[model samples]
Target: MADERETRPQADRQLCGLVRDLASQIEAHLRTRAATLGLTPTQATALCELTHPMTLRELADRMSCEPSNITFVADRLEGQGYLERHPHPDDRRAKQLLLTPEGSELRGRLVELLSKDSPLAPLATEEQDGLRHLLTRALIR
Candidate 1:
């Protein structure tokens, strides 16, 4: 039992390191793809998350960021003609963010770019499904 306890922490540390490394690789890939369209990683991420109109607070929550940070992102995207802000229907004090037609077009292109071949592309369909299931379970836990 003592031996098991000692190895558990080491195993957990190794798992954390592996997860971090994978996340870094994915972020680097996203950065490279975003640059092709003259967008920063954060802007690309924000655009990707805006599939439908939502409030800045909702966006911030989805992005795991502060509302102020999301404001900056929205400002940049709006300036670029990719998104627009309108008064929320029910909330006079809040604004909803929606993608412009141009934004939607660009988002489609971004999806194509991200869906292109990557490290996981070589996995068989069953393997991919299994990986997704395992990752989902891990995330929920």
Candidate 2:
């Protein structure tokens, strides 16, 4: 019985390994791209989330990270002239994040670099579409 169980094909293990390898490759590619932009991976991701203006808490939620982590990323990006903190139109104490001209330009370039044909792009369009569909289905649950 133990032998039968052990011999059963482990699709889950194989799929998990493939997913992990893909994720690692993406992380490495993004790290290289981030260095070229003078931004850390976290900072770049935060800026990506700011395609529209949002408050720090909102950004943190979108980033799925701690508020403090988002704050650190925001501070660094602001110092680099990639982001500006503006007074929240509705709240006296809260600040909204907006990209500077420099930030907008950088974000555009970043999008180009990470687009469908970029490193993260799958080898073929069909593969890319399939992965997207599968991942979307998985995420919806």
Candidate 3:
């Protein structure tokens, strides 16, 4: 039998592998960056969740984190001028999280930084569209 590298399309496999590595690297890089913005990744995610002003419990569920963990993230974000916690008008004892103007601006900048074009931009566009179509068809059942 041939060596594994010679047995298959090595370039294609390497490209896919590199894409996964790049994604991991991006996550780590952004995690560090969140600090420069006075937020942790969890806090940033919580603020992003607040575009809809959900309750702490609901935000915890959406963020797949424990309620206490959500509260900690929210508290930090709130202290950092990135979020506001207000009484839920419908439930005076419950609190809802909302993004402050600064948080919105930060989220926008984070999105922009994460979405900058790469040398693989053209191929990625075609591949991403194809993947989205295929995944949508597969998952929409």
Top TM-score prediction, candidate number: 1
**lDDT of every model, 2 decimals:** 0.92, 0.84, 0.74
lDDT of 1 by residue, 26-48 (tens): 78888999999999999999989
Worst ten in a row by lDDT for model 1: 114-123
**Candidate 3 residue pairs that clash:** none
**lDDT tens digits, residue span 1-141, model 2:** 887677655766788788899888787777778778888899878877898989999999998988888888899899989999999999989999999999999998887676734654546778888888998897895
1-141 in candidate 3: lDDT tens per residue?
477668578876886687688767756766766667666777756755666788989999988878998888888878878789888989999988888898788878766654554333445678978966865775585
Q: Which candidate comes out best when scored by lDDT?
A: 1
Candidate 1: C-alpha RMSD to true structure equals 1.9
| Model 3 segments more than 4 A misplaced | 1-23, 117-126, 129-141
- For every candidate structure, what is the RMSD over all alpha carbons to the true structure, in angstroms? 1.9, 2.8, 5.1
Residue-pair clashes per prediction, in order, are 0, 0, 0
The 10 consecutive residues of candidate 3 with the worst lDDT sum are 113-122
